[model samples]
Target: MIFLDGIPISKWGLQIQQEHDHPAVPELRRKAMIIPGMDGEWDFGSESGPKPFNFPLGFIEYDKNEKQRRINEFVAFLLDPYGRPREMKLSFDYEQDKYYRVKIANGFTPRRIHGFAFFDLPLIASKPRKNFMVPSDEIVMESDIPILSDLLWDTGFSDRKITSPQSFEIINNGTVVILFSFQMEGSGDNVSFSANGKTMTFKNFANKSLEITDNYVVKVNGISDLTISNGIFLELLPGTNQITVSGSNLNLTISESLTYQYV
Candidate 1:
C-alpha cells in the first residue's frame, strides 16, 4: 500500500496452490503513482500497519540563463531591506526507494559593499642614505689653506657629510653624459672643493676659465657658449682631457658627492 497526496493505494498480491486439483499463478513488479507535495504514509499489510516514507524533492531541470537570473534576483532581494518576496516553502518528492527535499527561504536585509582601486601608479621611492666625497688630490696646509690635485676623486669617499645632489651618469655608445647640479659662488672663476684630507678650497684657472657676470653663465672647454643658472648642469662628451673650466670669477659649492663605475 502507498499514500500520495493523502490518498491510499495498494499493490496487487498473488497466491498459488499447485497439486492434482490446484491452479498456478504468476507474480509481477509493483507500480505506484507519486503525487507531488504528498506527505509520505503507506501500508503493506495488517502486521506491517501504517509505515512512514520519504519523498524526493529537488530541481531536476532548469534553463541555464533563467536559473542564474532567478538566483541573482533572490540574492539582490536578500541584500535589499525594503524588497518584497512572493513565496518561500519546502518542496519534496520521491524516486525509486529514495526521498529528497529542498528547503528554500529568503528575506530582505540591509547590506553595503565598498572597495578601492588605483590608477597610474608610480615607481616606489627609495630611502635616502649617506653620500661621501673624496678629493682627487692629497691636502697639505699652507697658511691654513688647502689645495687639491688635478685628478678627479671618487665622491663616495665622503659619505654622510652633507645632503647629496641629484645626479645621473649614463653612456650612449661611446659617449658618456654625466648630469649633475652644483651651487656657484659670486666669483665664477673658481669653485669650492671639499674632499678627504683637504679643507674646502677655492680652485682657480688661468687659460680654461668660467666667468659669471650679473647673469648666471657657464663655459665648457674654454668656450663661453653656455649660460647657466644659480646651479650648474654639465653634459660632457667622452675623453679624460676633453673639457676644462677656467676663469678668475668662477666658484662652486658642492653639498654632497656620489660615485659610479662601469664594468
Candidate 2:
C-alpha cells in the first residue's frame, strides 16, 4: 500500500507494481591539489550532502463518471500552495514510516487506459526520506496556569483550552528536529510559543488565538503583558528544550510529537 498525503495510490487510480526506494545523492564533491614538492595530487577531504528520495508513481485506471476520477483532484492536491511543501509520509505497517518534503518534478502525463485515464509521475524530494518511529501522547491541563515542570516527555494538552499564561518542558530524544503544535482559544488575537531559546509568535491580530493552522477564529479573547512583537516558533533539538508560553490570555493546548531516529 502507498499513500501520498493519506490519499492511497490505489484510490488515486495508480497501479502498483512494487514499492521501491531509489538511491539519490543531492551533493557529492572531492578536493585535490598538487604542488612541486607534493605527490601527483594531495588528496583533500571530500564533502557530501544529505541524500534525497524519488518516487515513480504510475496510474492504472481513471474514469470521469464511473470511478471517482483523480485526474483533477490529484493535480489540485499536489500542486496547491500549502500542499506543495508539505511532508508526505509513506508507510508499510506504520512501523517503517518514511517522510519526505517534496515537490512534483516531472512526468505527470495523463494518458488514457482502458478508456480511462493513466499516467506516470516522478517526484524529487529536497532531502532524504526519513524513516522514524514516533510516539505521541496527550494530557489535559487542570488549571488555567498549569505547571508542567514534572513533565519529562512530550505530551499533548487540551485544545480550545485554558486562558492565562502557560509554561512547560520536554526532553526530545530524537537526533533531528521535531515540530510541535499548539491550539488555543484567543481573546486579544495575539499568540505565540517560546522554547529552546527560540520562539515563533504572532502579533498581527491582537484579539485571536494563534490558530494559524486553521486560520479561522469565531471569537476573539486574549490578553497578555508580554509586549507583542514578531513571530517565533519552537524546533526541538536532541536533548532538553525549555519552554515558556505567553500570549493573549489564550486557551492553549499543546501536542508534542516526539521524534526518534533508528540508531
Candidate 3:
C-alpha cells in the first residue's frame, strides 16, 4: 500500500507498479573543491541532499464514462490549488511507522492506451530523511506548594494526585539526533523540561497549556510565549537520552512525542 499525505493512492483506482531510484540514503551535498596541485582534493564536509522519487502508476478503472471525473479528482488531490509545491508526507506499508517529507517534482502527465491510464509521479524529498513514528508519553508532576487540610472538615484535597519531578530515559534507535515537541498542562509559577543536559524553562505558567513545537517555538494556549521562556530546546541523541520535568508551586502534567529520523 502507498500513502501520500496520509491518503491512500489506491483509493483513486490507481495501482503502484514500481518506483525507480527510491533512495535509502539521500544524495550527498559536498563542500569540497579540487585543488590543482594537491594529491587529493580539499575536503570540507558533506551532508545529505534532496532525494528524488519516481512512482509509475496505472489506473485500474476501464469505464470511459467515469474516467474523466475520477482522473480530475485524482489530479486535484495530488496538486495544490495555486500550483505551489508543498511538502506532503509519503509512506508505504512495508516501512511501518515511517514517512518521507516530499513535494511534487516536475509535472503530472497521464497517457491513455487501450482504455487504461498510466502516469509517473515525480517527487522530491527536500528534508531527505525518513521520519519514524513515536508514541506519546505522559507524566504528572507534583507542585512544590503544600495544600492546607482541616482535621474536622476533612476536605478531599488530600486525595488529589500529587506527584514529584520525574526522570525518564528516551531511546533513539536512529543514526542521528532527533528533535521533539512536548506539552504541559495545569498550573505552575515555573516549569522546566530537560534532556541531554539542556533545559527549557517557562515562567508565570498558571492554569494554562504550554507546548514546544517541532520547530522549537514555544506556545502557551496556542499563542507564542517565548517572552517567558529561556534555555535551549531539548533533543535526543542516537542512543539513550535522559529527560526530566520539574516544576515549582504548581500542578503540572507533561506529555511528549519522541520522533526519530534515519537518512
Candidate 4:
C-alpha cells in the first residue's frame, strides 16, 4: 500500500503471474529478443526505416528454488524533459537455469516511456486537509425524543475551551451526523465526555470532586444532546483527541454532565 499524505491508494493490485514449465528453453534462447516498445514488431533494421530503440543491456541470476516465487523487480528512473527522476517499477519472473540477457543494439529511447508526450502539464502544488464533516440532514437520532441540538446540524468543536464530543452512532439509512449538547451554565462544576466507560476531564472546566479549578469550563445545565447527521464530527478530548465518523451514518456523543439524566 502506497501512502500519500496519510491516505492510501486502494486501486492498485498485483498484475503479473509466473509461467510453469515450457519446452522451448533452447529455441527461446536463440529467438528471444526484447520486443520494441513493450509489445510491437521487432525492427531488425529492415527496409521499413531506422531500427527501434532498445533498453540498456543487463542480466541477473537467481536460485532455482526461488525462481517461480521471486519476480525480477526493475525500478526505472525515467528522466523527465528537464532530466529529473520519475520513479516506476516493473516486475516479472524468469526460469533460473536459463541464460537471460538483453542487448541494447540501440540506446534507451525516451519516447518508449508509456504516456510520454512532448507537451504535458507540470505538477500542481496543494495542501491536503482532513474532510470529516458530513451534511446535517442525513443524521438520525436513536433517542425516543431528540432535542434541537440533537437535530442534524453542522457543528465543529475544538480541544481548547470547548471539548469535542465523544462516540456517535450512525442512523437514518447511514447518513452522517453527531449528537451532543452542553448546558450554558451550572454543574457539579465539571464538564467532560465519556469514551468506553472512561471519563476524560476537559481542562477548561472546574471540578469540585477532584478539587481542580479551571476558568474556561462552561457549566452545563440539564440534559444536552447534539447530533451530526451527514458530515464529519471531530473530537478534542484531552489525551484522547480523535475524530469518529462513518459514511452515511449517525454519530452520538453524551456529555458527562448529563449522564445521570439519561441513566
Candidate with best lDDT: 3
Per-residue lDDT tens digits for candidate 3, residues 1-263, read: 77988788888888888654567778898989899989888899998889899888888567876877788887677678985777789988777567888888888778877679988989998888887643323111332211321111111111233256767766665667877576777787656768877887778666787777777788888998787688478788877677776776768666665555776
Q: Write the per-residue lDDT of candidate 1 for residues 1-263, one digit (tens) a residue.
A: 22222222111111111111101111223444556688763433332111112222112113555444544543443233555422221111121121111112223221212221111101110111111112112212332211322222322221122123222222211122333223232344343332222222234433343433213345444355443323444432333322133334433332222121111
Cα lDDT computed for each candidate against the true fold: 0.26, 0.51, 0.71, 0.24
lDDT of 2 by residue, 165-193 (tens): 66766665555566554444434345556
The best candidate by TM-score is 3
Residues 212-260, model 4: lDDT tens digits: 1121232333222222111222222212223232221112232221110
- 2 against 4, candidate with superior TM-score: 2
Residue 150 of model 2 has an lDDT of 29
Better of 1 and 3 by TM-score: 3
Q: Model 3: residues >4 Å from true position, as ranges?
A: 34-37, 60-65, 81-87, 133-166, 173-175, 186-192, 245-251
Model 2: residues with Cα > 4 Å off, grouped in runs: 11-19, 22-98, 108-120, 126-156, 159-167, 171-175, 179-181, 184-194, 199-207, 212-227, 245-263
Q: Whose lDDT is higher: candidate 3's or candidate 4's? A: 3
- Residue-pair clashes per prediction, in order, are 24, 21, 1, 35
The true-structure Cα RMSD of candidate 4 reads: 25.1
